[model samples]
Target: MTLSNSRFLFSAAGLALASLLPEQAAIAQSAAPATITVQVNKPGGAIPKNMYGLFFEDINFAADGGLYPELVKNKSFETDDHLIGWKAVKGAAGLESYIVSSDRPISATNNHFLRLSAKAGGADAGFVNEGFRGMGVKQNAEYTFSVYARRGPGSVSGMTVTLEETRRPGPGPETPPSGQALAQAQITGLTNEWKKYTVVLKPSATAARARLKLTLDGAGTADIDVVSLFPKDTWMNRENGLRPDIVQLLKDMKPGFLRFPGGCIVEGITLDNRYQWKETIGDVAARKPIINRWNKEFKHRYTPDYYQSFGLGFFEYFQLSEDIGAEPLPILNVGMACQFNSAELAPISAAKGPNAAGQGDEPTLETFIQDALDLIEFANGPATSTWGAKRVAMGHPAPFNLKMIGIGNEQWGPQYLERYEPFSKAVKAKYPNIQLVSSVGPSPDGDLFDKATFKMRELKAEFIDEHYYAKPEWFRQNASRYDKYPRSGPKIFAGEYAAQSVAIASPDNKNSWDCAISEAAFMTGLERNSDVVGMASYAPMLAHVDAWQWTPNMIWFDNLNVYGTVNYYVQLLFSQNKGTSMLPVQLPGNAKNGADNLFTSAVTDAPTGDVIVKLVNYSTTPRAVKVNLAGAKKVGKTGRALVMACDDLSVQNSIQEPKKLAPKEGQFAVSGSTVNYTLAPNSFTVLRIPAKK
Candidate 1:
């Protein structure tokens, strides 16, 4: 009998047998074991070097409180409400008042400064700063406290800085500062000219919810701007650096590239608030701050105090990519706001060119094109060049070697196409070598997305970005979504995608095992179609446990610690095991993908001379399969299997139990050219056998 007819007959016989027997006494017969054949000799296509990468956006306090290690929230007092993180000393009747002053500021851009008028000098006459969900400080760790301060007409000779743990009260409007001090330092030299003061404070005890207090020594007035408290041990131990633990986690992943500066932040709530890369560079204190696009975007998790300090800006992003050994891929604004927001677009016309547009005037399509050109120059230009000089002044004399740039972020329809036409042409006219990635609609499938894809093909775009956030079942079923894609058109960038356990953007969604396994099942398709799908990454890369607005992030952290989610491990495994070339795999009945709840894909690592086979078994029962490495010259007797399996789909990782759902490695014996292995229930497995053709 044919394969389909034999399966049908087997099911019919099983149903008949079940009908004849008692419900509780019935016993089922085992079906035939499955087989996967890998054509090792026929390596089809070369996998893109930058295949599996990362997508970073400034949502969920991913930058300010999560990655950027600056302890102070509004360091320069630059938020709309200048006193968001500052509170007056509760029992300080001696202190007069404090106000945000802009008189004779540090710079034209950073206009706000905290001016304190003290009636008397004592421990009580000061202000308290509640850090990002309270600072996470370690015992015997040194923290650098720096602030820009200048004395006004007063007798205040110095300032006292103290780090103390916060105390909670029982049912009343209460004070926040705990009198017990963990660390203390003093700033003795107060000058009329604005000068930066620095001192190191080593905490005597570890505190998870510590607050910083600044008290004056003498009765007087003082101005403070750019108040900062950063950990001494940062990533690479550089000044104004990232959190070491978080950076180490990213570096360990070996991501192929880093696409940065944002998702919706590229197109702001309005044209005015869009992330301007120019403003994000230069001195960290001088980089102007703006309200985060996600501050009030979601009403359920409303963060009215959310804002972007731009401390972690384009320069820092490029530096981070270099440190992690990943290519830098920067996405820029295309003179269009978010479609879901205002749907604003800049005027497009032939008259709008380099000579017509002024720096201070309203933006045109040419302004965006010019920005792209200048960005390329800034990233890869000689030190003698204009924008490149800015790079040299920032201390990086060498080029960032940027290769790819995304034009827009999750945009679609005729407006995008019209704007993209001239923008692409202008960029290519100047920097033809730089590849451009065009954007499509938010959802993966629809009339608008399809039409945009068609238009992008006609435009001969280098890459088309497609975003999708859907149920876990959608990911499992769409494992072969790109199997039939045309090979001659633009390559695919699965830019921002995650399998939502609940629903897209739902506050209740979780980074559960089910969602991670579903993503693995779909990533098999990404690997199988490496010829057309050049790049892919998970969305909203990081989230803070206390200050997050979005769910299902790849990595989650709090003030002091971070943990990779179940989805993070899946991405990590795929990125670490991505092979050099595609090795075609054949399953039972020549199924393309996801047959019988089993998903499989194979690739060969050139350097290691090993065959890497990735498999996802979604069934609840263990599955026995024979992996036949066909046309192999020599196969090692021993092999390795890295597996992550969980019985509960809803189980997740927390700060306390980070590695509860991590991968485990074990050895398996390979007999001749076939390896017989049983996949555990609901597991994602990667098998590596040392073999060569």
Candidate 2:
């Protein structure tokens, strides 16, 4: 949308918004607060015109990760076995090995286990564990740590877990300045068996955040589990606690849809252990937690064991999507499972009912049918479906009423293909109304997608979720990430996309601050071919940069704050401002830096007789765009614009400091049928001309 350089005159809408501005003055402070101009005119000799639009991804309110809670100040109780205070092993059955406080402190996280190895010289007290062993401390907040020990004898008092600030004896005056008694907790135990202890170290002083070491000086020989620290905003958060800043990112992007509980987080090793809809719903303390394969650093061991308190379950996902004005696209377990091997999977057949844990063998082939039934319940189940009933029990009686359900995520390798066909066929037969999406990708070393696309179409998948993680320049030059492509049946859902550096890890997509800008430029190509591409969404959407499992992604946020990397603005510009229909446009100049070059497309608001033109300048140097609006003369009057851009290519916007690249009004003069203006480099400028009428 274009306006003059003068102060914005209040329209009725503006006046209404102004009345509410008092409550949001702080929010205004949070926007980019800077301005860039946009110019528009009729296309004549040097002018180029075509329609502009954006492809949308329903990434569950555009939220992919982070444990969000339902209410604020509502601490979700969880136990990390790291703090081994005191416990009683009633017998071999109830408190085998040893029993720590699972009642008060919470029974979750890797830091809440006990270690004993006195009699048998093996772990005799505590839960069973696997992976590395050792005792080392002196870490930051929320660390992962392990311990070793032999079972202690007697009832409630022989041994204890202690932490000291002193350096060793005879260390030449190497004692710490201050001594803080971490824990003098007792280890009253029995048996001559080896036992391992693990827990999250709760620190007291700032120095403790730095000097944390694991030691087993208690009365027992012990084995140890790995120790590590949790990244900030450790697990699922609650409402009021759901980082408002992150919420704003989705609102600003104006996504048309969203998908949730996703990306590897789904299709866990087992059904009981999967991203269960039940565990991820209401009340954080009530949800059972699990481990994150992506181990964190500070956490000696990286197990996110907190009850999901699934406050943001299906209902919340739908609510957030609706609140942010985006459609919901959810992905459910297809039954193949993440772990290829059966032994590696968690036992769940016992948890639900008869075959709940799949006591017999791998889940029956018929197991795939359950998801189809679930899809119906989630989308149309009138508070009666088994799943819908569950949602209601959680509080919201109404189903999420969602229709878009995908089959799987990046299931490309042989494992994916071998397991996909069954789910696809089953889902199609049961619910033909819901749109189905599949994963497809560009050929990187481990990421081979072309073959998967072929298989998807062969299997008659409705839409292959196409993926492309290329360099910024590639996004611009290769507008047709999949143009003129021939698919037997499925349309395209640009599911997972970001500029990735295959040869090396990128800090940002292609390490380009202009990644989003170039993405916008390339979107023109996708919009032009929307006839074949039905939908799309960006992947690995949210990251704590600190807990970043992957890089070059779309959005990055922290516990209290969130920010938009350079790429986010480009997404905001296109998605927020797009045309209902696409118009053909061409760039005769052949701008340099493929991704940073100028790309064009146009659309006319026929009713108002106003024409809109979109120009993407993907260059480091500014270029003058000549508007030859010879055809727009009849409807042309004054021209205005809404531009989206940034000052520096690498400039980013965070909750504390946001940088807006949105288009502002620019000055333009109409000379009969021609107009001209110089556009900045690495920017997406959108211009709208007023009608002569």
Candidate 3:
């Protein structure tokens, strides 16, 4: 039978069966022992190297507060609201402060600096910066503090910087700072010329709600910009680096590709505010900051202070990809704004040429296309090239060796095609080796998706990016959505997807076991069709517990702690166990649509000579599956099974109970060629069995 017809029959039969007896239906389904036949020697196709990875967007304070690790917000005071994160000390008498904008600024992009003035004997005058939901400091951990300062006026001896713990009384308002100081630093040198001074302070105690205070000592005015504090033990110990704990979670996943700088951030709220790569390179201070596209995305979770520091810019992204041993996949705007937001279009004239009828000083389609070309040069061009020279000046003389570029993110319709066509052609004509990725809108099924896919196929695009945020049942039902995809069309990049427990972008959505298990069932289909589906990743990778704008992120973190949700463990299992080649697994009398609540996929590790079988049981009752390993000379008796199971489907992991739904490992014995394993209900399992030589 055809796949669709089979799916229909399965659904029909399931519905019919459900009408009989609800309680006995599950029992009846589990009564028969399912038989799975695995052909270990017959491999179908080689899996893509970048089969599973991460999609990082700047949403949910992932960059500024969660990962980038810069304790101070509004460091350069460049925002329209310059003093959003800073507040003057209440009791500091005769002290005044304001932001000073300069024509001859520190950098062309960063033009604002904080200026403080204090009268004689006004020693206590200074400002206090409340970090992103309060800084996270560990006991005895050394934190490096730095500031760009210059002597302004009356005799100023130096500045005293202190890290103090602040208390919150009940839930009303935050109380005054306690007398205890976590760390302190003294900067004595005051010169007329601007200079950067650094000091290290080891905190005597740990505090999750720590605040940074800067006070003037001898009464004078001092100009300060780029006030920053970072834990010395960052990822790789690099100055101005990412949080080690957060990076460690990503490192443990063994991701294949790292898609950086964002989902919607690529296509900003407006064309003028799109993510410009050139502005994100060079010096950290020079890298201009902009309001995050997600700043006020959701009305309920509106965060006006959210902005992109660009501290974790393209350079940092490339370096991080290299450090994590994953391919760097950067998505750029195709001269089109986010359709959901502004839907602004760039001026383009096919008959009149590249710059014809340009929109009065506004960037034309050619400019956007040129940005793509310049980005390629910046990433892979020789040192003599203009953009390449800038890359070298940023410290890395070697090219980042970018292999692929995504044209847009979840974009659709004729306008998207009009933009994508020229961008892809230009990129391919210049750099034929670099592959291009196209998008099929946000939803998996729609008229826009069909239109985009048809156009992409006509253009012979290399890859087509697809996104889906659906209900848990939708994921389980659509597991075979790609089975009917044409084998000769553009490959697939299941870029941004997550199973929403409640609804898309709803605050009520959760990273629950039901959603994770449904995703596992869907991922099995992705793995089975690895030839067509080259890459896939979960959306909104990280979220801050206190300041998140999105729900059901893979990883959730607070000030001092982070925990991976059940979905994280599901992705981790598939990613870490991604074998080299796909092996065929046959199930007789079992619905391919997983109507029996059993989904399975098999793969063989060519180098290790092991057969890995992934199985997900979605029923309420346990299932006993008899697996027959055919075409194998000898099978190892002892094998390992990793199972992620929970007693309740709605149970979720939190900061306090991180490992509540983590995987449990156990040894299973395989008798001859027939292995009988009992699969836990509502659980995902992976069995790695070796082949004896």
Candidate 4:
């Protein structure tokens, strides 16, 4: 076995692998004084069962009216869990059932359900349930329904809850479309109390595209709470049931891992006001939402739905990661507070002042510890475990086996640093099995660690979160920034990398070209160092035009329509072509006069004898380059190549126009240790070759 001595000069599309060692004919017949050896081998040991992990950021379930099964397409009028104290009122607006979650099991701070009534849409009269949008239910698909509700006083003898679909300005009854209907009875009964109920509805052939609707008709009111619906194929949660076009965009982008909850969610609030995991779970109504710290950025008094009903809670996150085939890496609230604390800081003192109401005083350390335990229990806890039992009750009994748990989104400063250490140690001590991730950077909330690897190591952090929101070209050039990272121990996770932010980033500011080129370049670095980079996940994975807090999200949607921005393709290109066993190949240096016009790197699966070279051309004009395989002892006469390139970098794909950025592959010439071809500007390309004899 022999190794190669090589010094490389890379410019435009040229690859000059100048051997630095004496030539060895035994290994390969090379012409240059710089000797090279490419040792190729067959497929070796088994590869990991999982190659990639992907999924959307979902909190929509908890945001939905509740996790209780929305009685869409059910046989009878049924209520969930909350079956008491709800009274029916005939108002000018119509027959509205007050849904209050204040009953025994429906109290806040955990166990809570809605109190409401159920009846049938008696031809002329009906109940209109608001939308529980999420996980792609916005699109037409097969759905299952369930709920936990009970009948109240004076129930309808033969009441039914019919499923109907209508637009926001919805049409009237009779002429109204029937999505699916379910009717149940035993009405006109029960005293002040709470009972459980369940119903299943099958879609008629008439069922088409529409959101879930649970209509109670034929008179009588029943207290209700907790409802949920299941769709065969949809987004993990409602928040990002973003359109398929956008999802497919992400699938195409080979990001190593997703860092989320924020590019800003890290701005930790005071102790009581932190992202309480308990509040984030089950039933949107029961889960009081919170204001987004970035709310001020929108230039409007907008509240962020961050106080998510975690119905799509920790377990759901894991499910989403599993569904999308992306690893789950979510942030948990670590004690230290990181928010805008100025003159107002005194009021919200840890235990004194007005802010003290929420975080002036931190939670009892015991509560913090319990929350951490609950988080883990939800991830890998057995079905019978406390939180795990709830998960089983929620439907998905199996554990998500969460591998990465991030503590504190963004908590910096000496105070936070002091606090973070304990949280870090606590998390590590408790969940020795899972990898603990730390945030570094001034996110909207605060706790951003340091750039120096030593500082990161000083904290004993397993991983550091690196975020970037800049022009596309910045992404391109900055992608290589990690190459020179001289650190061991704590790996890097590109948790929130994006080209644009709504208020923080401008779409018009950065041309689509910059987005494409920069992101491509950035990703190349992440892939090159996948060994050191455990994973990468895009931030603002989605944006609702009406609900957008950030611009240039990986996926964006408006109601029924959706689109993938120009930057999305960068992720798609790498995700689709990612190879294991990252071969260490030195790219040729910069172009003539040191112009960094092109970037190149190669990875080979020594076992499979397969070689992959990724060429990123960031120029406006097309450039030709050659991949030098001279040092690669083995060389084949011919091989295949897959390229994902577009004519223009600024050209984006919209709902009205998809396929604008998809990849189209073609075979190029591969002769000797060199494979040569033209690379379009602002484009990403991947080439694969076989090991020679």
Give residue 509's lDDT in candidate 1 (0 to 100): 95
Candidate 1 segments whose C-alpha is farther than 4 A from its true place: 1-31, 90-93, 169-175, 350-360
TM-score of each model, in listed order: 0.94, 0.63, 0.92, 0.72
lDDT ranking of the models: 1, 3, 4, 2
Candidate 2, RMSD to the unseen true structure = 12.2
lDDT of 3 by residue, 41-143 (tens): 6888998999999999999999999889999999999887888788775343646555566735576677888888777424257777889988889999998
* C-alpha lDDT of residue 72 in model 4: 30
Please provide, for model 4 over 1-693, each residue's C-alpha lDDT reduced to its tens digit, 9 standing for 90 to 100: 011122222222222122212222212222221211222232222222232334244322212222222323211212232221112323243344555554565444435554444333343333334332322233234454545555555544333444444333324432233333332222223335654444444444332234344334445555445554454334544532323344454555544444445433433444443566666555443555444445434444243332333344455555545655666677765555455532112111233333445534435444555677787787678987888877777567787767777766544554545555666676678778788777665442222344333466876677776666665546655656666675467777666666652234553433254566566666667766675676666555665545444456566554445665555555665665565555554444432211365665555654567677777767554555555564555666555555445545556666666446655554455567766655554456777677643
Q: Given candidate 3, what's the lDDT at residue 68?
A: 94
Summing lDDT over every window of 10 consecutive residues in candidate 4, give the lowest-scoring window: 1-10
Which portions of model 3 miss their true places by more than 4 Å? 1-30, 97-99, 121-123, 169-179, 350-360
For each predicted model, how many residue pairs clash, with residues at least 3 apart or on different chains?
0, 137, 0, 92
Full candidate order by TM-score, most accurate first: 1, 3, 4, 2
Q: Model 1: per-residue lDDT, tens digit, 1-693?
A: 000101111121112233222421132234455889999989989989999999999999999998998888898988889988887763445578888998999999889999888888877678778888888899999899999999998898989999988877423243454657999999988989899999998999988889899988888899998999999889999988899999988988899999998799999987777888999999888988899989898899999888999889999999999999888989988888888888877778644323222444567788788988999999999999999999999999999998889998898999999999999999999888999999988989889998999999999999999998999999999999999999778999999999987888999999999999999999999999999999999998999999898988999999878999889999999999999999999998897689988999999999999999999989766566789999886899877777787768877888998877887776677888888766666889898889998
RMSD of every prediction:
6.5, 12.2, 6.5, 9.5
- lDDT of each structure? 0.86, 0.48, 0.83, 0.49
* Candidate 3 local Cα displacement, residue 405, angstroms: 0.5
Candidate 4 RMSD computed on C-alpha atoms after optimal superposition onto the true structure = 9.5
Cα error of candidate 1 at position 569, Å: 0.5
